[model samples]
Target: MTAAPRPKLSVILAAYNCADFVERSIRSALDQQGLSIEIVAVNDCSSDGTLAVLQAIAREEPRLRVIDSRKNLGPSGARNLAFDHAAGEWGAVLDADDALQPGALGPLVQIAEEREADIVAGSIRFFSHRRQEISGAVFREDAPITALGLKDFVEAARPQNREPDYGLLKPLFRIGFLRERALRYRTDIRHGEDFHFIVDALGAGARYILAREILSYIYTTRESGLSRTRVDYSRMIAETEKLARQAPYSEDPMVAKALTRRADALRMHELNVLYGDATGLPSKLKVLARSLTSSAGQRWLKTKIAKRVVH
Candidate 1:
């Protein structure tokens, strides 16, 4: 008998207590057109019916491979496990709560094949679960496909009024490149793992291409998600510090400067949190003084003062 041909793409999906949306996510991946893809889903010890749902689906779908984790391994660990089991040339990630639109994989694979890029990323369509509405695309739809380097990624990481981190825009990664470099997600970090992974890949000299026309990955916002429940300011700071110290930014003055500014913004946010909780005048004054020392702090102070004046 002839053996089955290898799939072109392997989608790593990590699910933890996402019973409500897991099935739809799997279906979306399976529904992707123009690509021979395999879905490698890891159930991260979900107490709900997530594991059962995946099992039932996998029994019928030969392309769907479900791995049940004996213990809860957060997002990073679960994805790492899926990656280990993946056998495709390219790797894509889809959160159990999110999905991939039809014809998503083909364009990405084409870009990677044509440019010989290590990573091919595109815009994401944001959908609000509560509102039942598709808000808009994250990156500009009209933007042309552009080659990106470490500097481009660092510049995108800079803190701004809008969500600055483009990590949520899931990209198709070359599996061979990642394996050769031994690149894997940091299992320690519960949040910001995607940001670190992308930065690390860029630092490792991975060729990146942004495909503006391929806006198929759907990022759905949930009120009960971990990001919405609590804000881990310290974790964000630690991730930023690691990114600042990465080899790609160390020798480059511009990238280093941008990282420093981003760090300052994170520090200012931490101080703001303290200021909001401080009850005594002396404590508030101390926070105010600290805020004045950093550029981001000064901006924050100006914004607050202007708001007060207007009110």
Candidate 2:
């Protein structure tokens, strides 16, 4: 028997307790036109009805497949799990709480084809529960950016910029390229797994494409999953630091320097979160003491004071 045709793209979606939004999100993927797509969603041990929502959609939608995990494997683990079952040549990350903009895939796929890029990072927009566009795309561009390199990626991702963090942008990946390099999301960090994955791909010499104008990924500002948990900034720091110590990442002196700067910025974020989470006078005092005594913390304090003065 002839095999059924493969999908053009597989949406690597991992959802947790997002039952209220998961159905809408899955329908959005199903409603997409001009592309034959398959949705591979993993239910990461959600306490809510997220798994039921996924299973319900799967039973009705032939293109949608749901996997129920025995335990919570975090975002990276769940996505990695979905990817293992993907049958498409290309892949795109979709959050369970977010929906894809209509007709978004065509232009992204076009850009990838024309540019011969393995990855395509598109612009993002925001929405709310009221079905309102809370904010527009992250960039205003009439054309897409191509041939973006490691140095560019690192600098764009650096914290404290007017531009949104590049790491936050979800880019489409060529499944073959990722498989060629054995590139997969790092399960260690929850907050910055995309950044780490993209870095690994770029380091492995995959061609990068940037779509600065196409708002392909629509992000919802709902408080769930990662939003519900306290982010460990140190995980991001350690992951970046680990990359900085590796060969291809650290080989380029300038790239290595950029990684160091990024790590420092992450350290600042770590200190700020700790300070904000500190409750009693003793804990607060301890944070202040650490900031006062350490060089990295001193820089953080200086930046903190600088921002306060500026505002």
Q: Of the candidates shown, which would achieve the greatest lDDT relative to the real structure? A: 2
Question: Which ten residues in a row are the worst by lDDT in model 1?
Answer: 222-231
Q: RMSDs, each prediction?
A: 3.2, 2.6
Tens digit per residue, CA lDDT, model 2, 37-140: 99999999999998888888788888998889989999999999999999998898998778788788877888898889999978887776565655866787
Return the TM-score for each candidate structure: 0.88, 0.89
Backbone clashes counted, model 2: 0
Which ranges in model 1 have alpha carbons more than 4 Å from their true place?
Answer: 158-164, 224-230, 246-248, 265-295
lDDT of candidate 1 vs native? Answer: 0.81
Compared with the true structure, what per-residue lDDT tens digits does model 1 show for residues 220-277?
7755362312456677876676667766576788777767666776777687788898
TM-score of 1: 0.88
Question: Backbone clashes per model, in order?
Answer: 0, 0
